[model samples]
Target: MPSPRLPEASFPLHLPHVWSGSEMGAQEGICAPSTHACLDAQLPGNGWPVGGVVEVLQAQPEDHVWRLLLPALGQAVQAHAGPVVLINAPREPFGPGLKAHGLPAERLLSIHADKPSARVWATEQALRCADVAAVLAWLPQVKSAELRRLHLASHQQERMFFVFRPLHVQADASPARLRVMVEGHEALKVHILKRRGPPLASPVLLAAQTGRLAELLQARKGRAAPPQAALPVKPITPTPSLAHLATAAIKGPAPGQQKIKEESNVERIASALDRIALPG
Candidate 1:
């Protein structure tokens, strides 16, 4: 038996749904929570945007931020199946600390570029690569246009891109979806200076494990420090004798004895020259 066929409904191939604050849309600011629940509550979308550029402004850039990011970054690496990339890191990463935090050595990659231009170039390139789970670049100075370009490149891959700039840039305008100042303290202090949502007034605090940090320090304390390469032995600079200085200070040809000594030196030099064999 043939059932009655319903009329077919056709929909457009590409329907761009423009959105507003009223209607709930997936395209809106949907965020994953930060590693810390308190911080997540403060941030827009409940947390930082997963697929946007985040500009991290700090007075100093050290691995301390990694503690706050450990939870989020661990998930990101697992989700994306890519290693976290670091560009122009200030110092070599402490491997034991990372291991203690649950991030393996294989999951991390550090690119050392001394020059600012090289660092910028490497940072941009790293941001564009979809294979990278996240990129942390320390950019002390950069143009707004260059940052915009980085923002564009960052979004293309839909991976997290973090540029660590000076805290002074907190006043400067940027194109990143999230801009926060990460300051070092007993606890990790983070303040969202800029974002797409309501203004944030207070800073978020993430606890630091003093015990684990101390234990790590203790463990490393036993290992012998890297033998510093021996510095070049400087030629011994002999102290000038008082006699030589006194002799030099005396008015030259006025002393007959000194004049005679000068003539003797000239004769010695001439005799030495005469003794030398000349080329035919």
Candidate 2:
């Protein structure tokens, strides 16, 4: 005899952790919504996975790290009320820029490590900290084994973790649960390299800047720049040589000699004034 079939509605689709290969998987643990609507839609669990390393591959270290992760980091700061730790950042974090993105400087903890080992070590230690809500590390020279170690450490903790590596490293195997490649300047073209579900056919375009920062940039681009004022050009007068002065003196007083001297004095005074008026 044939067994009774399960109802379609009775399928385990309702479970938060279960999803088919055709569909994106859902995260059983807590997730931080990546502020980007298109990116979040493509991400598993509709947001960043909290218990795993998210490998971000880019041509340059500082290309789209802020543009892509600012929103999620800002949210993490607010929700977890913990500092976002950064290891081996290429440049010092600009406090004003962070504030413009709604992420206060006080909420960030930056660790400068020159060596790759130090950087990986710092990231692992940061993940273990209870007060850290997120950890972003730049480990260009880090090996796959180090990454796996970091991933395992992150998996034990419930926090957002991101490791940025060179774009060439994508060809190598990684232990990260999610992987993405960031490109473009004005707008980010994010290619989901590896995920729990099917591969993305096209890249997701995300705004490089948003909020007041974007508004200001847009306004500047839209407005026509004012014309620059032209500087006044003064005709240069040749200075009298010592020989010429001697000749003039030897010739004695001629017609309107005093008047000529007075005119020359006025010219010298006007030239001095012009020098003072012009900017350096």
lDDT of each: 0.61, 0.69
TM-scores vs. true structure, each candidate: 0.66, 0.69
Per-residue accuracy of model 1 over 1-280 as CA lDDT, tens digit each: 9997765555343344443333322333445556578887666666667666788887877667766666666666666645576766686556677766656554555655444655666566567655567777778877788788888887776767778888777778888877888876557788877665556668877786569875775676677667434223232221232122123222123433222122334443222222222112
lDDT string, candidate 2, 1-280, tens digits: 9999989988765665456678777666777778789899998788888888999998987634687777788887776645677776786555555667767765555555444655666577678766566889888999989899898888998778999889888799988889999888778899999988888999998875766666655665586666424234443332232223223322323564322222334443233222211111
The deviation in Å at residue 272 for candidate 1 is: 61
| Pairs clashing within candidate 2 | none
In lDDT terms, which candidate is top?
2
Candidate 2: residue 46 lDDT (0-100) = 85
| Candidate 1 Cα deviation (angstroms), residue 222 | 8.1
